[model samples]
Target: MIKHIGVVGAGQMGAGIALVAVQSGFETSIFEPSKQAQEKTKAYFQKKLPPHQPLFVTQLDALSNCDLLIEAIPEQEALKIKLFQELDSIAKPEAILASNTSSISITKLAAATKNPERVMGMHFMNPVPVMKLVELIRGLQTSDKTYHAVKATAEKMDKTTTTSKDIPGFIANRILMPMINEAFHALQEGLASAEDIDTTLKLGANHPMGPLTLADFIGLDTCVAILEIMDKKPCALLQQYVNAGWLGKKTGRGVFSYV
Candidate 1:
């Protein structure tokens, strides 16, 4: 029954989610105010999906007709709550509003809207087109009807779905960030060289990439954000990287130099 999908923000996660939505045969509308971001997203679509085109607009009003609206903006709680308040007014009475937040509280986000039942967390993984899992979190007021509808929609995108309670960091980040933090701690304590630490994890733990490499890929700034919101304190080493504007792969330098 969910035919049209609206995506806010045309950044990496947003573009990836919109691409999958189009591939799943849903009518998609994406709102991105930045011309640079719009061009980047367009280029990405042209490269990955040459034929299909989702409606792209600079104004939020263009998404009024969408059956489901997914917000894929940055990981800032205040910004998200403000957007949700505005979306509550613009979205249809029955349309579902979902957030792609990694660690923020969905129940708290739902509190910003007039009808909380329809708001839930539809946290898609980074590089969404390639990742297989979609973590679905139900807010305290999220109804069964809303949950099932979003689950079916995610399945249509060919993603495996897992349900998590509305907790800080939810399931994926709750487990993943702590291990990543510990890796930063190890590096800071001079337990091993960055290369050695990464190599040990890759060879010994059989992980696809070492934790530092994964953190770089995930963006050091994002790691800091997720950790700051979680119950645990962020590793000082990680914050230092973010403080220096070394946000990993995107910034060309993080724990290691990519330049």
Candidate 2:
């Protein structure tokens, strides 16, 4: 059994993963350089997790001793490469390196690391507790040991794991983004207000949230990033929303106002 888990980045995914790891008996540490991020992540854990859970650290070097270091940093290739390069030097030869990337190329990331055999992708959906599915991506050089280890970790987290080849948008988001883009198209066409669009989806389509609202939750910047990578044009209204700095609940405005 893996005894130690390290997570880089103290954002939503990293914090949630840390909470679940510690709750499952793994000694977990979250490494974030930014002080505010460190405190915010710890505060999140303090509120939602047990008081006796594992600690959080402020240096990436702290992850060297971990059995598994999961990188939940930004989706940019250069950033991931830089972090992986440092992690490769610090981590043990047998330690697994995992990426929480949504759409980046796993093979490229693996190749950037010293041990491609030990690198794999672990894509956890948003609202980690509520989302049950995780996508496990294997690079061309990923070894069986690394793949199975991450799969086992997800299982221990009580998450359903689906194996997928690295592709733009991975799996779910590949299909979901087009739908969200369509919703914006419909709204721009004057078929409905954002409220009406969402209502139609939740009531008529049996979804928990409407596409516009879901896009907001996903972050407009993230949506545009994914769309641009997928070679899909951003719906005009969304382009405008992104231009205006109304990024969503995180920014207090989007398809709907936070207040």
Candidate 3:
């Protein structure tokens, strides 16, 4: 039933999700307030997407017709709540609202909107076009109807879906982030070099990428943010990297320099 999809925030995740939606034949629109981000997204789609382009809008009103609107904004709770409130007012009454938050509370986010039952978390992994898993989270008031509809839509986009109860970090990050943190601890302790640590995991544990590399790909700032949300203190080395603004591949630096 989700014939039209709208995404807020034209960042990497937003652009990737918008590309997937349009590639799967949904009429997609992306809303980004910043002209720089809009231009970046347009350039990305020009190279990756086919001739047709998803509507890129500078206003929230353009999302009025979207059957489902996925918010891929930053991980700030206040910002998300404000956007949800605005979306609830601007989008169609029947539109399903979803957040791509990795650590924030779905229940709290849903509370911002009058129609809490229609709000849920659709936490798509980074590099959305390639990531196979989409963690679907149900808020306290999220309806079964909303859950199933979003699950079906995710399947239509060729993604594997897993339902997770509304909890801090949910299933994926709850387990993954801790391990990545431990890896940082090991490195900080001088137990092994970053290369050896990652190589050990890649060859010894069969992980496709080492924890440090994965941390870079996920963005060290994001890892730190999620750790903070879970009430888990990030390792000192991780905090140091974040403080240095070496956020990861996006910034050309992180655990290891991309340049």
Predicted model with the maximum TM-score = 3
In the range 39-117, model 1's lDDT, one tens digit per residue, is 9899999899635799997789778889999999889999999999989999989899999999999999999999999
Residue pairs with colliding backbones in model 3 are none
Give the range of the ten consecutive residues with the poorest summed lDDT in model 2.
Answer: 49-58
Kindly list the per-residue Cα lDDT of model 2 for residues 131-194, writing each as its tens digit. Answer: 8899999989999988888999999989999988888888887999999999989999999888
Most accurate candidate by lDDT: 3
Task: List the candidate 2 regions with Cα displacement exceeding 4 Å.
Answer: none
> What lDDT score goes with residue 182 in model 2?
97
Error of model 3, residue 187, in angstroms: 1.5
The TM-score-based order of candidates, best leading, equals 3, 1, 2
Better model by TM-score: candidate 1 vs candidate 2: 1
C-alpha TM-scores of all predictions: 0.96, 0.94, 0.97
Off by over 4 Å in 3: none
Q: List the residue pairs that clash in candidate 2.
A: none
lDDT-based ranking: 3, 1, 2
Whole-structure CA lDDT of model 2: 0.85
Candidate 2, 119: how far from true, in Å? 0.9
Query: Compared with the true structure, what per-residue lDDT tens digits does model 3 show for residues 234-254?
Result: 999999998999999979999
